[model samples]
Target: MAPSSQSSLAAKPLSEFSFPSPEVTASPYPFYEAMRAEAPVYKYPDRNDYLLARREDILFVFQHPEIFSNLTYLADPAQAGRVLASKPPGSVLLTNSVLSQSDPPEHAVKRRALRGLINPRYIHSCEQSLRRIANELIDGFIHRGEVELRSEFADKLAVLTICELAGFPPEDRDIFLSWHRIGTGHGARFLTPEQRALQGKDGPEQQAYIEKTIAARVKEPRDDFITEVIQDQIARDGELNLPYLTGTLRQILTAGNETTSRLLTTVMKLLIEHPDQLAKVVANRDLVPGAIDEALRFEAPTQWTSRLVMADTEIGGVQIPKGAFVFMLYGSANRDETWTDPDRFDIERPAVRELNMAFGGGIHRCLGSPIALAEGRLGLEIMLDRLKNPRFAPGCEDERENIDNFQKRVPKALHILFDAQ
Candidate 1:
């Protein structure tokens, strides 16, 4: 939890490695070369699983169900209790939800149900809305010349877009924001026992708040996704219980906000850091989608997602035994040479070769990816439109990996001086 990985390799055992190094997790690219070279399937004396750093290996674990498993691992009572105890247990859906915590039949069922609400075509239709939100946020901050990228732009855009899609009132933004903060806080290395203990309040608080709100929506339904799930199709099967409905909502609220926030933040930070790249996109807004892909490749938001090995498996000469945990170190994979230049953030990067393991692969791939891309594209376009002379703050260069391997920091905070039109 010291967070810096600058010298972690030297401290790590010959066979083991560390993640989210205070420095690396804060800003990881510098340390990735070392991670890729010294340890790909990194063993950590402190953690329960071996971390996969190489792109090929991480993608392999992500796509190969026979070798890696997310269902059992996410539901491990011990893991659940640990993460859950980290905060309050209000919703129970955080642990019991099918999208993030369950596997196979149950995961498939919830995934399909969630998918039904926002089909790929439906997600595409929301592009205009996303663009509108992006423009609104960037418009406010562009003239300020300097803005706190996280709180002002990324945070607001992600939260507002997802909330609108989910049909939550903007007036209740604080409530949903609180829930997301607590859910992500689970296992955050920066927190001490006391701070983590304080976080426990998030559980019960979120459950109560969501249940009440969603219940109201159920009775007096509207045109939102929440209404759709509760009144219309949620009861299609008698087994579609409250927990299931709430669980899907939890997944949407959390996944939708967190990942897209990171994506937008990184895109802004990257554009500022790489002014030339920003210029390319300005010349061709059509490059916005490709820019988003490159940004995801450069610094993916949801860092490492691990799977528990239900059965023994082999990869790259290593034999993973049953019950072992396989961590897909996406941050490391994004920079792995086995894939591409790995370091450069190029908007024109090849499409098929796009480093996609960021959204996950196979059955568990993020159901909301279509929206994530749309949001990122919209957000960056708006930010770029107003950035007259964007540059990193003096001495404020992105210092290390990120706040955590889970959430990334772009330029950390962007300080740009925009000229008046």
Candidate 2:
């Protein structure tokens, strides 16, 4: 994230740029800015893929799922099979059933099966629990006066909030955290089989536990998403698809935490860097929602998402071949010309009719967005309420690092200090 990173990128040819250049993860905004202007539909040099940076181009791809597929695995089964062949059994079992990875008819059925996730009544009902979870997380760190907000607060709060929604036990937090770490960290593809085996060692126990929960729900229904999905699937398909549930649960357990946790962490970092904005939010708690939106725009948590080009097509005048993976740079698109001074982190920015594409768009737009927003708003509000005059912990500016992911912007550490009551 040094100043030279920007200059280095400026000096390079658009063709010379790599998909995941060394400095992209550390200082992505500058890279995103350049890509948006120069290489809006960049063909990544490393592979048969494209990086879509402009808001217009990304929106076009989002709107046309038929032309550009979300089911990357099905679209290119050869690649999918090769990758899954190396992945751990747990991942191999769960990757395909991911709802966002599919299109129409299939996507519709799965989406409808899990509609309770976005049900207004369910969200409204969970507000109290979400608030309570946020406060409980604050309670753990408020008395300490100094705490690592990433682990103690943001990550824990996100997991617990998802736990509340999924009807997963709060006691299983360590499990969720560990799984998320392995899933999002270096990834299973890079790890050796021995390493992957070590990581997925608990697969049987985890599966058994989930099966037990599903059986319990089958007998005595609950209000949680797991129960909602189970009943709806049975009603639609006349039988339960354990593989479907397994994949959905895997997505819920990991994807649910990654984006939201990173959002909470990044938002906290942004506010601390701009205390004036933090003070404004502190004064007008109503601005909490706006702050979350601005954070989504300014520093999107999930930075890159990929869609398969279903057929040869032109986006921003660039020809993308069939089966080419188009990487939608959400970070870049969110900062596209759509906003005046898109780089500035302004909570006061006028609310736009088309908000940023941080959670994606179309039918495949993030289903967990309502929960993530609610969790973020309530968590930040509680932090402001409980931790007065929060600021960064001293002497760790260079030590803080983002997760080793091009797609996610989560930091490994977010140390902060606050005045205790």
The candidate maximizing TM-score is 2
Candidate 1, residues 1-421, lDDT tens digits: the string is 1122232323333333244456554555555566566766666565556767776787677676755765543446876665444321342233344476656655565576566446767767777877777777777866667766777788788888887677777777766666635324224443545546655657677666678778788678787788777764445543335655665676677778867887887777777678788888888889888888887877777766767787787767777778777767676666665454556678887752345667877788778887787777777777767766666556555542255333444444554455634
Which window of 10 residues has the lowest lDDT sum in candidate 2?
A: 1-10
Candidate 2 per-residue lDDT over residues 1-421, each given as its tens digit: 1112122224454554544544766767766666765777887665787888887888898789898877666555785685345323432223334686667766776676677777778888889988888887787777789988888888888888888888888998987776524333223433446656765776666667677778888899987778887877666556666666766776777778867888998988999989889989999999999999999888788776777788899988888888788888888877777777666788988863256788888888888888888888888888888888888899878646766555667777988888987
Q: Give the TM-score of candidate 1.
A: 0.83
Model 1 vs truth, CA RMSD: 5.9
My TM-score estimates for the predictions, one after another, are 0.83, 0.87
